[model samples]
Structure formats: C-alpha cells, structure tokens
Target chain A: MKAQRIASLTFTALAIAYLAGAFFIKEPPLRQQLGPDAFPKTIGVMMLVLSLLYVRIEFQRQPVKEDDERAAIIGAEEKLSDYVDYKTIGIMLALMLGYGLAFESLGYPLATFLMFMAGIYVLDLKHWKRDLIIAIIASFGIYFLFRYALRVNLPIGVLKFLFR
Target chain B: MDIWNNIVLGFSVAVTPFNLFLAFVGVFLGTVIGVLPGIGPMTGIALLIPITFGLPPNSAIILMAGIYYGAMYGGSTTSILVNAPGESSSVVTCIDGFEMAKKGRAGPALAAAAIGSFIAGTFATIMLMILGPAIAQFALNFGPPEYFALMFAGLTVVTSLAGRSLVKALLATTIGLAISTIGIDLQSGVSRYTFGNLEMLDGLEFLVVAIGLFALSEVLANLADMRQAVMERLSIKGGLWLTKEDWKRAIPAFIRGTLSGFFVGGLAGAGAAVASFVSYGIEKSTGKHKEELGHGAIEGVAGPEAANNAAAGGAMIHLLCLGIPGSGTTAIMLGALLMLGLQPGPLLFQQQPDFVWGLIASMYIGNVMLLVLNLPLVGMWVKILDIPLYLLVLFIILFSFLGVYTVNNSVQDLLLMVGFGIIGYILRRLDIPAAPIILAMVLGDLMEQALRQSLIISDGSLGIFVTRPISLILLILAAISITNPYWGQLGAFFRRIFGQKTAA
Candidate 1:
C-alpha cells in the first residue's frame, strides 16, 4: 500500500512536469491540425488523471490483515533487503557504469577484463584464481569473436600495439 | 495453387545452406537460453540482436523466430528435471513433469513433452500458412482510423492483462508512449522533446530499452535473490519411447492443447504462459485420467508443452498478418522487423513473400531440430544448468552491455540503458509490469502516426474514429478491455440495482 502511494505520487509529479514541457513546445509556423505537442499533451493529461485516480484507490483500499484469507493467498509482501543483497548490487552498478565510461578509452580488452574481475570478486570472493581465469578468457574471447567473426570494430585503446 | 507455389518458394529459401545453418544455430542458442532460468525468449532475442546487424533481414528474422519457438520446446527440460520452470510457460509442466521424474518415468515424460511440442508446432504452423494470407488480405482494407483503433485496442488488452494493478500498467504504457514521442516528429519535421541531445533526436532505440528493461532488470532481480540452484541427479532409466497407453492418453490432450493454445495465443496479450495454464486447466477437467494429473499423468506434461510451443506459432499470426504483436517477445520481434527496415503489415506479405514464407517453412524444420536435440541430447542440455550462477550473471551483464554498445557505439546510449535499467529495477520492486512498456513503445510511433493520419482524413473531426464500423468495433473492444478489472464490481452493482427494483 505504501509502495503504491509513493508510486502514485511520483507519477503525479512526472505528469505535471510532462504537461509543463508539453505546454512549452513551440508551435510550428505551419502547424498541422494535430501538432507535435498534441499527442504528448493528451498523454500527459491522461497520466495525470490516472495518477490521481491511483492515489484515491490506494487510499480507499482496506489493508490486508495477517489472518485474512486474502493475505494467505497473496502472501506477505517481501522487503527488498530480505531477498536482495544491496551491497552486491551497488557494487555491480558502479562497475557497469565505470565499464561503460572506460570502454572506449581503456578499450574493450582492458575494460572488460577489469569489469569481469571486479564483478566476479564482488559476487564470489572465495574463488580468486577461478575468477581471474574467467576474466581473462571471457574478455579476450569476446574480443576476438567480435573483432574477427562478427567484424565489429572495438576500440583498440591500449591494445593498439598488438595490431602494429 | 498459389498457396502451393508460395510454399515451394518458401521451402526453396529455407533449404538454402546458409538459412538452414542459421535456423539450427538459433534453435540451439534458444534451447540453451530456455534451459537456463532467468533469461527468457524476450531477453534472449534482445541480447542477440547485435549479431543480426550484418545479416539480411530475412535471415535475421528467421533466426530470431527459431529462437522464439525453440525456447518453448526447451522450457520443459528444467521443469521436468529440477521442478524449476526454465520459462514461465512451462510452470504447469513442473506439476506433473517433476512428479513423473520422481516416479522414475522421466524418460517417457520428457518424450511426451517433445513429441507433443513437435505435433503442436507443426499444426500451428500449418494453421498460420492457411490463415496468414487471408488475414493479411482482410487487414489490407484497414484505413488509418481502423488501424489506430486496432492498435489502441491491442495496447489496452496488453495493459489490462499485464499486471494485478490496471493503473500501474497503464502508467507504464503512458511512459512508453511518452518516451516514443521524444524524437523529431516526422510528420511536421518539428522537434518534440530531444532536449538538445542529438541521440534523443533519433528517439530511444526500442532495442536498447528492451535490453535494459528485460535483460538488465532481470539480472538485477536475480542478483537480489541470489542462491545456488541445486539440481538432484535424476537418471532417465527407461528408453524415451512412450507406451501405447501413454500415447492414447496424450494424443487427445495434445489435440486439445494445440487447438486451445493456437486460438488463445492469437488474442492480443494472451501468450504461451496463459495458453499453457489454460491447457492445463482443460486437461485437468477433461482428460481421460484427470485424477492422475498432478500425481504423474503424461497428459499433464503433454498438454501444456504442446500449448506453449503452439502458442509461439500462434503469436506469429498476429505479428505477420496484422503488424501487431501478441506478446512481449513478438513485440520485440516487431521492433526487429522495423529495425530491419521491413514493415510487417499487409504489404509485407505482398512485398516480402519469401521472407514470410521462409520463416513459416523454417518453423517446421526447426521443430524437427528441437525434437532431435531434446530427445538424444537431453543430457547435454541438462549439464548447462550446472554452470555457476555468478558466472552466468556476469556474462549476461557483459553481453547486454556489448549488445547495447554495438548499436551506436555511443557511451551516452550505454548510460541511457543503465538509467532505464535502474528504472526497470524500481518498477519491478513496485510490482509494475515492464512488458507493457515495451509493447507500447514499439507500437507508439505507429499509433500516433495512424491517429494523426485519421484526423487529417477526417479534417480534425473526432467523429472519424466512431464513424467507421471497424474502427468503432475496435474502440468498443478497447473500452471492454479497460473496464475488464471492474467487471465484477460492475456486475455486483447491476445486480443490486435490479434486485432493489424487483423488491420494490
């Protein structure tokens, strides 16, 4: 119920922002009957109405009791921390972001190798040797597959000397 | 005679060594993807789109189509073996399939699933061959108003069936349509919401969003619940041959399942998962050995396995004939078609007969390949499950990055994909369905175009949508779909009013 309320509020804000943006869209000199802004404006209004409706419905709904038959059927709502290892996820997110940013500069080989190693370490720290082997093989293997078989151009970066 | 000629041409194209090889590769990879849980056909197709960048559009679609149906065939493997359904559509298979494995009838259970899938796939493909052209011909008469109404109905049906909450599903859809409106408006050549980023000018690529939403989000969700998937070694003692008694019970179930699956799958938003569940229900009520269903009936496995594979074929009908996808995977397939510079509606059949027919022909051959792979190579496929989960997750992430990067080689796109991935994760936590978002995004541009064109034709009159019979009927269907969640309340309300009147 709390999640629904939060989501509704978020969408309501988004709808308002979107409407404001739609309003500011410049009307073309020779605009068609339905201009470029028409679709977005209509969608924005619909979203706003729906978001408000969502808020109303969430508020009107009775909370499920522990002993309720519906509670048994639907089961208890799970907390995020109960199932998810947020620490691992956060590490992964940072690694992926860094990998993307470094992809061209460090090239595919160095960047992918470092990303895989770090990712595997974060996920499973006990097997450093296995992780190292996997990182090297995967990084170089994918590089060769893309470079040779698929003929996709990857950034040479630090690997430019190999071609030379 | 014309149909016969088309079939011949289709076979001629499908039989070419290159196309045949690609079909084999597609089904193989699809089976692997299906055998591994967490990665569905939608993600599988999305992650592989980069490989098809250089191939001809026909070959790429043929390969992807092979994966779509091939996953259906492979989904039953894990269900029977580990009691874990590799695909959502195979959930029913776990009930009886796992029970059969426990009873040492694993071989026959697996065989039933394979044979049923093959039979259902062939039947559905034949039905597609017969109905496809006719439907396309009929839809060729659709005007802009009718097309807009049809797409509107499609989106509503998909949204209504997507999740438990109608508002959340619709909001996701609204967001998708809004995202699609970001690029330069084609009709007027006016920039809508590029926000000064040149990348946004081309609009967000459906492929990028699909990978982020389906692939990356799936990975993140799995990471949260990370645990070692333990597989108990179950040996298939007997040969894979089904007893005559098994065949007798299963044959009817297969027939029933295929029929139900094909028709249900043709409906927008009803895909293999729904069809499989529906088939299971039918088998439970109507099968000869209905009492033995959950315990270990061959019909239980036969029915749903057939239904899912048949649904894969059934989904192709709407995608090929009407240009509307029946499910998330097919929606991605539609995006692929559009990306390949091929329009998938009525004109596609006339213009790209070989491509359409070749795909149809490949399904038949692909079904055979899946059967051969599943039967004798079942052991090898099961071994794939033994791969460490951490490694699997890492590779999925790497491949997703590679696939998105290869699209434009732009770091901005990668960041955008990451951003959507975060949104997808949040939405997942919020219990919002992501499939509707992709479905809406893929169809959004076309829906807007159709709506604008209809308005132009009607000279800005809103009555144009209601004036046309087909358009009006479709709008009615959309209304029905939107009101679907409230139908029980509506029925109760009507009953109360009528009861009061009767009492008075």
Candidate 2:
C-alpha cells in the first residue's frame, strides 16, 4: 500500500511538471493545422487525471498486513524486504552503469570481459578457472562476431596498438 | 484464381535457398529462445532486430515471423518437463503436460502438442491466405477519420486488457504518447523536447526501448528474485507416438482450439495468452473427458498448445491487412517493418505483392520445419535448460548493450536503455504492465498523424469523427472498451433502482 501511494504521488508530480513544460513550448512562426504543443498538452491532462484516479483507488483499497495470506503461504510473517534481494540488484545495476561508461574508453573486449567477471562474482560463482574461461570466450567471441562477421565499427580504444 | 497466383508467387520467393536457410535459422533460434525461461517471443524478436538490419526487407520479416510462430511450438517443452511455462501463453499447458510427464506418459503428451500445433498452424495460414486480400480491399477505403478511429480503438482495447488497474494502464499509455511527442514536430519542423542533446532529436529508438523494457528488465527482476530452477530429468518411456484413444480425444480439441484462437487473436488486444486460456476453458466445459483435464489428459495440453500457435498466425492478419498490430510482438514487427522502409497496409498488397506473399508462404514451410525440429530433437532442446542462469543473464545484458550501440553508436542511447530498464523494473514491481507502453509508443505517432489529418480535412471540427458511419462505429467500440470493467457495477445499480420502484 505504501509503495502504491508513493508511485501515485511520484506520477502526480511528473504530470504537473510535464503540463507546465508543455505550456512553455514555443509557437512556430508559420501557422499550421495543429500546434506542436497540442498533443503534449492533451497527454499531460490525461496523465494528471489518471494519476489522481490511481491515488483515489489506492486509498480506497484495504492495506494488506504483514501477516496476511501471502505470509501464511510461506509459513512465516514476511516483509517486502524479505522477498527482494536489493544487494544483488544494486550490483547488477552498478555493473551495467560502469560498462556503459567504459564501453568506448576501455574498448569492447576489455569492458565486456570486466562486466562478465563482475557479474560472475556478484552471483557468487566460486569456480574461478571455469569462470575465467567463460568470461574470456564470451567477451571476445561477441566482439569478433560484431566486429568482423557483422562489420560493425566497434571502438578499439586502448587496444588500438594490438589491432594495428 | 488470384489467391492461387499470389500463393505461387509467395512460394517462388520462399523456395529460394537464401530465404529457406533464413527461415530455418529463424525457427531454430526461436525454439531455443522459447525453450529458455525468462525470454518470451517479444524479447526474442527485439534482441534479433539488429542482426536483421543487413538483410533484405522480405527476408528480414520472414525471419522475424518465423520466430513468432516457432516460439509457440517450443514453449510447450518447458511446461511439460519442468512444470514451468517457457512463456505466458504456455501456462495452461503445465497443468496436464507436467502431470502426464510424471505419470510416464511424456512421449504421447509431447507428440500431441507437436502434432496439434502443426495442424493449427497450417489451418490458420490457409485462413490467412483466404481472408487477407478481402480485408485489405475493404480497408483500402478508409480515410483519415476512419484510420484515426480504428487506431484509437486499438489503443483503448489494449489499455483496457493490460494490467489490473485501469488508471495505471492509462498512465502507462499517456507516458508512451508523451515520449513519442519528443524530437522535432513533423508538421511545423520545430523541436519540442530535445533538451539540447543531438541524440534525443531522433526521439529515442524503438529497439532501444523494446530491449530495455522486455529483455533488460526481465534480467533485473530475475536477479532480484534469484529463484533457482531445479530441473528434474524425465525420459520418454514409450515411443513418440500418440495412442488411438489419445488421437480420438485430441483431434476435436485441436479444431476447437484453433477456431477459437484464430478469431480471438484477431481482436486488437487479445493475444495468444488469452486465446490459450479461452481454449482451456472451452475444453473444460465441452470435451469428452472433461473430468480428466488436469489428470494427465492429452486434450488439456493439445488445446492450449494449438491455440497459441494458431494465435500467432491470426495476429499476422491484422498486421498485414490493416497495418495495426494485435499484440506486443507484432507491434515490434511493425516497428521493424517501418525501419526496413516497408509500409504494411492495403496498398502494400498491390505495391509489394511478392514480399507479402513470400512471408505468407514461408509460414507454411516454417511450421513443417518446427514439427520436425520439435519432435525428434526434443532431447537437444531440453539440454538448453542445463545452461547456468547467471550466464544467461550476463549474456542478455551484453546483447542489450550491443543492440542499442549498434543502432547509432551512441552511448547516450545505452544510458537511456538502462534508464528504461530501471523504469520497467519499477513498473513490474507495481503490477503495471510494460507491454501497453510499447504498444502505445508504436501506435502513438501514427495515431497522432491520423488525428491531425482528420482535423485538417474536417476544418478543425471534432464532429467529423462521428459524422462518418465507420468512424462513429469504431469510436463507439473504443468507448465500450474503456468502460468495459464497470459494466458489472452499472448493472447492479440499475437493477436496484428498478426493484425499489416496483416495491414502492
């Protein structure tokens, strides 16, 4: 119930901001059939109305307790935290962000290799030798497929000397 | 005679070695994608869109279409073996499919699903050939107002059917429309919301959003759950053939499922998931051995498996005939067609008969290939389940990045994809669907164009929408779709008032 409230409130704020932004769109010098802001303005109003309806619906619904049917199924009282593993998700998100940041600078092979190794570590796969071989093969195999077979111009970055 | 001629033309194109090879490869990869959990047909098609960039338009569509129906064939394997559906449409199959496997009847169960799917696919394709040209001819008369009304109805249907809450579905739809409104306005040539970034001028690539929402978000959600799958090894004790009694019960169920699935799938919002469930319900009520449905009954597996595969073929009718997609995967296929410089709709029949017919013809061959691949090669597909889940997640992430980058070589797009991925994950947690957003985005620009065009034609009067018969009928449908969920409450309210009046 709290998550639902938070999501509705966030949508309300976004709807307001978007509506305000829609008003600031500059009118074109040449007149047309419909202005550019017309569609956005309509969509903004729809979002606002829908968000308010969502808030109302969320409020009207009964809040589920910790010891509800869901908890009984698991044979223990549970909270939201017990269902989701935030740490693993956080690590995966960080790995993705780092890979995107270093994709061009670190080149495809090195960055992908690092991403795979980090992913394996986060998953707690303890076989280092097998993990190393899998990561190396995956990173370079994909690079070769894209770079040579598909003819995509992937960046070489620090590995330029080796390629040359 | 004309239909016969077109089929010949289609066969001529489909029989070429290059096209044949691609069709085979497409169904092969599609089966692999379907055998693996956490990757549905929508994500499978989105992930492969980049690889099809270099192929000819006809071949590209053929390959993608192969994946669509081929996934339907392969989705049953996981359900029968592991009691887990490979995709949403196969959920019902798990009921009897897994039960049969446990009872040592796995061979007959597997054979029933394969043979039923083949029969359904062939029947639906024949229906498509007979019905495609007629519908396209009828839709050729649609003007701007009619087009706007039709697309409006499509959006409303999808929004109504998606997710639990109507408001949340509408919110997702509005967000998609807002995203589509970015970049330069085509009519006025003025930028709307670029925010000074050159990459944003393209208004966010469809493939990036698709991959992020369907593929990347799935990986993230699975990571959070981290539920390990325990694969139980089940072997087919008997030969891979159905008994006489099994055949007697399954054939009627196959016909019923195929008929229901084809028409239901042609509706704008209803897809294979709905079709399969509807078929299961029908079988429960009407089958000969109704009480045996959940207890290792072959009809239970045969009905849904056939319905889903037939739904794939049925979805193509709307996509090819009217230029509107009936499902999420078909929406992505529509986006691919637009990217490939081919426009689907009425005129496409006249302008690109070979391309259209060739795709239709390839479906016939693809179904045969799928049956061959699925029956004898069932053991090989089950081996795919043994691959570690962590490795799959990492590879999916890598492919998501690679797909986005190869589109424009833009790092900004990669970041944007990750952003959508996070948004998709959040939405999934909230029970708000992501499919409607993608459907809305694909239809957004086209709907807006039709609306503006209609207004222009009507001299800015909204009354033009209702003045035409077809447009008015479609708008009425849209209104009914939007208000469909409230009908039960409305009936009770009216009944109470009438009852009180009678008592008084």
Over B190-265, each residue of candidate 1 has an lDDT whose tens digit, in order, gives 8877788888889998878999998888888878778633557576777878999888988999999898888875
Candidate 2: residue pairs that collide: none
TM-score of each: 0.95, 0.96
Residues A1-164, candidate 1: write the lDDT tens digits.
Answer: 68778887898999999988898787887868799899999999988988898778778876423223321222211223446778777888898899889888889889999999888778888888977988888888889988898888887688889889
lDDT of 2 by residue, B15-79 (tens): 99999999999999899988998899999999999889999999999999998888888889988
Q: Candidate 2 - CAPRI tier?
A: acceptable
Off by over 4 Å in 2: A63-82, B227-233, B267-269
| Residue pairs that clash (backbone atoms under 3 angstroms), model 1 | none
lDDT of 1: 0.86
Shift of residue B325 alpha carbon in model 2, Å: 0.9
